[model samples]
Target: MEDPYEILGVKRDASTEEIRSAYRKLAKLHHPDLNPGKKEAEDRFKAVSAAYDLLSDPEKRGRFDRGEIDASGQERPPERQFYRDFGEGPGGQKYRAGAHFDQEDLSSIFEQAFRQRGGPGAGGHRSFNMRGADAHYGLSVSFLDAASGAKRRLTLPDGQMLDVNIPAGLQSGQVLRLAGKGMPGYGDGEAGDALIEITVEPHAFFERDGNNVRLILPVTLKEAVLGAKVEVPTVKGPVHLTIPPNSTSGTKLRLKGRGIRGADQYVELKVALPTEEEIELETFLKNWEPKHPFDPRKHMRGR
Candidate 1:
């Protein structure tokens, strides 16, 4: 794995704001929604996020810098460093791999290993000094609820209920962390955090386009032929839109600030021909013909 500082483009001693700014900038640039189907960007985004997670936490960062843990957050085993020391016995005695020893290093390792394994030591007592594992949960939310913010009460597996705050403009699959709400800590350790992955339900009429909302509006033949004002559905509610005269199908109109975060809601017009069978309308259409020969697709040469 690349160094966390290099991935975040910050110095090892960077300030909190500097680290935060770097992370935010990179996150926005490499967000999956912004760069869809970009595998390289997605991979980099994951790496960057992991790096930020490690560096952002003061304790983890300290451990990483001090060589106590690896970049992947796994605790480094001290056996290798102490192997040479424990290889030789007190009087230059050589102990091969898997060989038992009674040296100080071997005794320390055995004591810690036995304690972790829940085995009673010479004192015939089990002791635990560790933090509890973080808990994970899932939450379902509506598209609008994700666009706008909402609060929900969720019951965890442990029967603990937590009030989750859904942030505005949060994307699907994003996690909402509730600190100290996970499994209780061991002994006097701090409680683990609760991580809730947000699942935003798809909307029926509205489609998400980055920060914008997209919708298809059907217009009548007369409305398309001549300019008309029509009501269009938006997240904020229905609003009147002015369609230009002689507007063709696939014409788009932008309703400014109608989407989340002040994004414009784009409406594409689809001209629908009338299906009502009226003798008067048929007779009028037969009598009224184009003044000149016109072909809408005259420029097309081949399919």
Candidate 2:
């Protein structure tokens, strides 16, 4: 596998936001849906996703930087230490290079250590049964899917497919644990869990606030002036929203229980005029006389 930084075209010292931005651009360009039936694009997309999976994690990134792990996220062998690497003990005793040790000697050394703490191997033989380490993974989901609750199948770097259930109103940085889905355990111990971190892609039209949803809906000038029921989009689907008469830009309307879970959706109305000029409308406005003429910037006058 290529270095994650090089794969994402980011420098080693790049900021988190910079790395994320690069990955997003590459992911979009090589996404399978955007390039259907193109094997090259699909491969590139997978590589980009994998690279992001490693670099986006702080612990993994630090380990990789310290040479404790590889680009593929696998652990590297620890550097070997010899007698010369050790210093003198409290009694000025130095480690002897010619000294030999066997499995029984190591077990007895551990036995004494456990005996002091009254651990499992204090009185009996050492079991040495240990649980495996937990596995970490990353998954990306659409905004609607995250808000509405959906199931996704994640492909791990090892080519394993794992089913993931995203709960409704799931926030970013939340982890999902799959029991016994991690690395194999030693001896008779059980396996560890699989920790999956989710990243929700931003929607082009909707913004999330807590569990609530926000949107800026464009209404025609006539509709704003005369009032009408228009189809508005929600995370679930489109619903009819009533625009009050004389509605103007920045007028906020609430759709109860239309957001993620039981939260509400806020729609701000923006009155949009005709793209082409209307001679009749222009003439009417020119001769229009307002019954109540008030300063539009009255608040600005005092300041």
User: Which candidate tops lDDT?
Assistant: 2
lDDT of 1: 0.78
**How big is the positional error of residue 145 in model 1, measured in Å on the Cα after superposition?**
1.1
lDDT of 1 by residue, 24-127 (tens): 67866776656767878777776776677678778888989988778766667766656764677778877677775559756677677656546566655556
Collision count for each candidate, in order: 1, 0
lDDT of each residue in 188-275, candidate 2, tens digit only: 8799788887889899999999999999999999999999999999998999999999898999999999999999999999988899
**Residues forming the 10-long window of minimal summed lDDT in candidate 1:** 152-161
TM-score winner: 2
lDDT of model 1 at position 260: 82
- Candidate 2 residue 53 Cα shift, in angstroms, is 12
Clashing pairs in 2: none
If scored against the real structure, what TM-score would every candidate get?
Answer: 0.59, 0.67
- How many clashing residue pairs are found in candidate 2? 0
The local distance difference test score of each candidate is 0.78, 0.81
- Residue 216, candidate 2: C-alpha displacement in angstroms: 1.1
